[model samples]
Target: MEPTTLRAVMAALRKPETGCPWDLKQDHQSLARYLREEAAEVLEALAALRPGDPATEAHLCEELGDLWLQVAFHAQLAADRGAWDIHDVERAIVQKLVRRHPHVFAEVDVEGADEVLTNWAAIKREEKGQAADHEPRLLDGIPASLSPMDEALEIGRRCAKVGFEWPDLEGVLDKVKEEVGELQAESDPVRVEEEFGDVLFSLMQWARKKGVDPDAALRRQMIRFKGRFASVEDDARAAGGWEQRDLDQMEEAWQAAKRKGKA
Candidate 1:
């Protein structure tokens, strides 16, 4: 009687005769939301982590395990259908890593991280049967699951690699201003939406050129806003309720919080 491992536990949970009803009923499509949710929880846990804090470390570990469960569950479902299993998934990634990292696994020499990345892309293209002489598709290798901001950043990077980009940060900033002007001038709802998207895309390019991660910047801003807003909420509660507070009072509270270094 050995202790059951994660794979074995997943298999038991999906067993037809004795498995939990909810576990037995799940399929890949139905489990997709959980996969996304678990990944988001892992990100939140990572954001909450503090140096030398065991509680935060434990929280991150738990969230990561929840994310891993989604992978194991999917593998179990595939195994039940006689397609593949967890080991197949693990082995495929291991093989791909070794195949891609020629600098470590083979005799290929790279001077720096940039050269390593360039070599990795070349190797990846070769593996995908993209011939060296063939004109590569602009967005062929970008993952479809990337967020729109991330996708825009990748698109900008790919285009820049082939000398199809603004020459300087000022050029990108000018493009951003142009896009904003177009967005502000649009009146029709459909056209406004399109123009707004263009503005966001241009801003993403600007962020890329500025060496800023838009997602991380947004997350940090939101965290600051949350803390400031919590101060406003406390003020509202002290004054009776939200109904008793006005926008100016809320602004004062927010400014106080900002002065207190919440921002």
Candidate 2:
């Protein structure tokens, strides 16, 4: 049978006997890495977007579709096991959104975005069966699957909500410096690794305090570095390849690329 819809297509691909062999071999755990990869590609496509560039827009659209396929694939896997399917996934999100947004769906009043967020958190806790007077654990709801940097930022944000954070930007800056100092003083490899993690976590908190998305900042920096390094590689190729060019020559090329603002 010809699959007409996205969900139908996924179901067709996962169908036994006539289905794709590779698709039949995959499970939720096996598809996890592809999900992460598709999401990262979507982010990259978003970063490459320009105001009126149709090519970049198309690229973003394609990447988003790829990410959506991961969702559909997982939903198909669940369906194969006699669990919920794609429509259930869609309905669940719709129900959750309507339930969470009382300010829009109900008569609840909110002053601003912040108040809306506050109300949303309260509603989420209530939905989780947490009492209004209950003091939840510090990192109760934070997902363990989050990247370390994101986990650090969440930890800082959660603590800040309960008045545990530093008073000002200066205090965060001092903490960053202190963590860096501790990292620098570490000699043992294990201790060094631990201190380095502390420094990174401290920097993540600092970035949160400064209203910066650390992941986006790091991605942009990596893009810029790649651009500059490409120039250095070009210079090396022009001078008879990498074997002929020294670190100083590469550094000069990198500096020139930086001066030209390659990214």
Candidate 3:
């Protein structure tokens, strides 16, 4: 649909006399979470889109509608505040899209997708005034509120950009090993804690260098661990009881459950 028509539709939805009460009541802060949820739903639907999957299409439509709802709701809020209406929002984004894509809209030369990426990066760097060496710059861009694992990845990427990175995956592996050795040698509680954290951080850095999302990778492992441990608990309860088993016995059972996950 056209931007003008979409704005009209949103205006109707937030009309004081006959609009959606829920939408009218929402603010930016209130609708912030819905954006994330709808984005995840969109991603989920896309992931499940395959041959002969009617449900996936249905899910995709619903997710898109949810996302649209957030956009309209926010536009309404902005209109109410007299800051900018939905038209301004649409116009701003349209302008930004044309401005960013010089390759398509302008006579700018490009070789391939790589050239486009270089142009895009150069545009962004020019906008942000990024340094030539990229020294301590990406770190400056990463939000302080980002999750710890995500911060590790961001910091690792920043360092990698400056060439303070492992030469290869083997070096990362060695770094992890070194941290582990330090962890084992430390006896002071504080020192041990720091060493163990160093190991985890090194592992996260290694994952980044290997093109792995350490957070998602660890979350996958955590899900598997939870599933297997729950199974062990169930097995122990059915056999006799977990309380009846000693620490070593329970540990053995847990290990067996982990092996079952590998199968």
lDDT preference between candidates 2 and 3, better one = 2
184-258 in candidate 2: lDDT tens per residue? 998999999999888888899889999998887777788889989999999999999899999898899999999
Query: Per-prediction RMSD in angstroms?
Result: 2.5, 2.4, 5.1
TM-score of each: 0.87, 0.88, 0.68
User: Once superposed on the true structure, which residue ranges of model 1 sit more than 4 Å away at CA?
Assistant: 1-4, 181-191
Error of 3 at 225 (Å): 1.9
Tens digit per residue, CA lDDT, model 3, 8-74: 8778767797888877787899888888788767755655555477886888788898888778778
In TM-score terms, candidate 2 sits at 0.88
- For candidate 2, what is the lDDT? 0.90
Among all candidates shown, the one with the greatest TM-score: 2
CA deviation > 4 Å runs, candidate 3: 1-25, 30-72, 85-118, 128-138, 247-263
Error of 1 at 147 (Å): 2.3
